[model samples]
Target: MTEDSASMAITLSEQDKTTLRIAAYGSVTLLSAAGAAGGSPHKIATTGSIALGSATGLVGHVLAEYPKSKELNGRSVADIADRVLPALTAAMSLLKEQAPEEAENFRSTVITAIESATHHGQPGPVVADMIRKITKALDAA
Candidate 1:
């Protein structure tokens, strides 16, 4: 199969993946010290949720626009998960210097984002495994 075809073999849409990707980035940022310091922990968490939901909704709309194009179906859930974890870790590191509370909130947001992402396709176990692997490295740091 062609590379595009191979990637698109999965049922999930590119828009779905992209939404998750964007949510991952935004969620990671919310976990950053700058994000937490700029607002309350609850606020940061709630905003992150809203941002992720918006991205996911956009993904749904985008998927509807290209119902037959597998181009919009490319990418496995694992691939999307890979993008999320590293971004979160990096964001946390940069924000660590700001304060302990910020770091805690940042970590909290990352965890919540992972939880939300898991609620989509496949089982929660698969998503949890990816999150565990990524956090393993982060925890070591």
Candidate 2:
């Protein structure tokens, strides 16, 4: 994060931070699950997560602090999506309201993560669909 952006006086509660983390990391998890059929789930998660770790600005600061794994929902793609997709939209809305400047940063961070996750190989229809849904949710805000 640049010194200026890092010092931006944005306010966010713990709940809001958790929401952003879940939305971003859970996005990678969802992609991992979707690509499990004939893809490297580990690689999908690793790259996406790494991309998130590379985020800049307030989004970067929030994302750098990992969420409690146990707090993340879902054992399946559908279940996870139910929790994460809304979180994705909610996260966007929260950022737009609480930190309007960081809103685009958050969106770009998630998309970069998604692209990193899928760029490992030819993403199948399932992965592609997941990406579309994620993008939709992010835009829903």
Candidate 3:
């Protein structure tokens, strides 16, 4: 039992290190994606926030795809849902201040719908809406 416990600790530590490394690389990808999304037409501040949010969303998507991380490895679906929902919420908050009011409202509704569906354990609607919004947003950029 002692040996097994030590091995698990080592594995967890390695997983944490890997997650951090991936997260750092992911952050760079996010920054690039956001900058590409925020072309020259937007207000400088608005573009910056959207760029940040876009990067964050990209990072969240990537992290969520990973099967395990020290923080998320054994968490329940609800716990995962809890973490997933907030990224979108935070993105919406940043976007609301920067995006057109109507566009911001639509994105917020889309995120809320996704979160509600995830909470209910039927996430198809939420995912579909999210994908739709992402496609639209990307195309508009």
Which prediction has the highest lDDT against the true structure? 2
Instruction: Give the clashing pairs for model 2.
Output: none
Tell me the alpha-carbon RMSD of every candidate: 16.1, 1.8, 17.8
Who wins the TM-score comparison? 2
* Candidate 3 lDDT over residue span 22-104, tens digit each: 32222222222323333421232233233334322323232233334454322343443344334344444433434333234
Writing each residue's lDDT as its tens digit, candidate 2 over 5-109 gives 553668789999999999999999999998898658899989999999999877888889888887565767788899899999999999999888888989999
* Model 1 CA lDDT for position 18: 46
- Report the C-alpha lDDT of model 1 over 1-141, residue by residue, as the tens digit: 653343333344454434334434443332422233333435444544554444322232322232232322225444434554554555445435433334444455445554554333332343345456546634543
Each model's TM-score, in the order given?
0.38, 0.93, 0.25
**Per-model CA lDDT versus the true structure:** 0.41, 0.89, 0.34
TM-score of 1: 0.38
Candidate 3's C-alpha lDDT?
0.34
* Clash pairs detected, candidate 3: none
